[model samples]
Target: MTKVDILAFGVHPDDVELGCSGTIIASVQQGKKVAIVDLTQGELGTRGTVETRYKEAADAARIMGVDWRENLKMEDGFFQINEANIRKVITAIRKYQPEIILCNALEDRHPDHGRSSQLVEEAAFMSGLRKIETSLDGVAQDAWRPKYVFHYIQDRYLKPDFVFDISAHMQQKIAAVQAYTTQFYTTQTADDEPQTYISTPDFLETVKARALMLGKRIGVRYAEGYLTKKMVGVTDFNSFVQETT
Candidate 1:
């Protein structure tokens, strides 16, 4: 079985890049094997064609040093969080069997983002149930679910249950996002497409500011916040540093 240390799921190609690339890069740098599974080809994006998004996703994956990145080719804007989609995600979850799963924000600006998170969350829960059968390549797959599921903060700032210090990995995160040249801020244009909310130059700066703001809450230089459905358990306080001046 092909297993990864962390598996991130995004509704669109750049959602992962914008939301949690810093933490992803940090985890990989710490010797964890990470992978990304994009639920859509982002065909509905304003700035880039599906082909361009695919190439850009590949570039971002390379920059993130992810072990693998896969696309499910789901309908970009209309995909539903139904059994079929749940099973599709389940197959990838079992294939990777990651210890941690980084999923889209529970709720976000794009309806698809929240929907994708619900689909993945339901799939993860069902995957742990042995009775829910799934198959791939004509073979029956074993039930597998990630130990932890973290929903990254996105367009809307939902209060995070916790945050990870990512000061050192911030630059790498920006580079990964910039890898999608067809999407974000750039003077050079391949076509005469109009700019969207994400294509603005300030978008990147806003991302940095958001991280900094989150970090400040915990007295850190940078951090990515996440929400948890359940309270996280910690065996000892020593595992977390106490900030004191």
Candidate 2:
């Protein structure tokens, strides 16, 4: 079975790149195995087809140097935090048994993002209950929960529980997000297609600015912030490197 140190889940194909690519890349650079699971193919997105988004997601994964990537094929706008989807997430939680699981913001502009966050949160907990059975390839799997689940901030500003210093990895994060050529600003994205809020160049810059502001708060050049369901305690201060802006 393939094992990973971190597993990130996105409500849509490019959410992971937009939200936490910096942190993901940083973890991989530190030799931690990382993977991404896109819950939807983003077929409903204004700019790209599902096939195109799939290719883009793969390219982003390559840019980030992740070990594996998977798409759950869930309905983009219609999926619920019900049992079926929860069980699907549980299957993956047991499959790789990652040390950390990163998911979309618990509250965001996109309703799906918030719902997915709760779905993943509950499923992670359910995965640890031996009574809640989940199987992989017809074989019963043992219950396993990750050490931590971090929700990456996106769209709307929510107070972060902690922020990761991603100054060195910022450019790489931008590069990974740019891999989704079909989704963001491009000279070729027909003027007649009716540009949405995210298809413009200015919005992309805002994404960068958001990261910069969050980084500035913690005295870093760039960083990605996350919120946890419960308080996180670090046994040693060695785990953090304070940066003074």
lDDT tens readout by residue for model 1, 23-88: 899888899999899999999888879999999999999898887999999999999988889889
Query: How accurate locally, in lDDT, is each candidate?
Result: 0.89, 0.90
Tell me each candidate's RMSD, in Å, in order. Answer: 1.3, 1.3
TM-score for each predicted model, relative to the true structure: 0.96, 0.96
Give the runs in model 2 whose Cα sits over 4 Å from its true position: 187-192
- In terms of lDDT, the best-performing candidate is 2
Lowest lDDT 10-mer window, candidate 2?
186-195
lDDT of 2 by residue, 1-245 (tens): 47899999999999999999999999999999998999988988988789989998999999999979999999999998888999999998898889899999999999999999999999999999999998888889999989899999999999898899889998899888888877787565556666788888998899899999998888889888999977898899878867764
